[model samples]
Target: MKVMFSAFVAALVIAFAAPMVLNQFGWSVAEQTSSASVRLD
Candidate 1:
């Protein structure tokens, strides 16, 4: 039971921390691409 609890806590911490870690290196799911152009007629 203790192992399961620890695993759950670790998973939660990783879930919350992964995004910030990725963004620290300029990697993010919301990153924008400049190659796509929009044409409005």
Candidate 2:
């Protein structure tokens, strides 16, 4: 039970932090899709 609790906490922290970490590198889902729409227009 202790090991499972620790693993759950670690996963929660990573899930919350991953997006902020990725955004620092300028990776974005909206930017990519918007550019494609502009090209089609």
Candidate 3:
């Protein structure tokens, strides 16, 4: 029972945190690409 409860909590935390983490990473990548100084000139 305790193991199941802990697993449920872990899943909940991951469900909530995953999106935020992914968003931050996506935004960082986008920012880097947009502000890249290595122009293909």
The best candidate in terms of TM-score:
1
Q: Evaluate model 2: give its TM-score.
A: 0.66
lDDT (tens digit, per residue) of candidate 3 on 1-41: 99999999999999999879988778666665686466686
Candidate 1 Cα deviation (angstroms), residue 26: 0.8
- Please write out the lDDT profile of model 1 over residues 1-41, one tens digit for every residue: 99999999999999999988998987765565533567879
Give Cα-based local distance difference scores for all models.
Answer: 0.84, 0.84, 0.84
Give all TM-scores, in the order shown: 0.69, 0.66, 0.62
lDDT of 2 by residue, 1-41 (tens): 99999999999999999999888886878755565435434
Evaluated at residue 5, the lDDT of candidate 1 is 100
Badly placed stretches (over 4 Å) of model 1 are: 30-32, 35-41
Residue range with the least summed lDDT across 10 consecutive positions in model 2: 32-41
| Angstrom error at residue 35, model 3 | 13
Give me candidate 3's TM-score against the actual structure: 0.62
6: Cα error in model 3, Å? 0.0
Worst 10 residues of 3 by lDDT: 27-36
Task: State model 1's lDDT.
Answer: 0.84
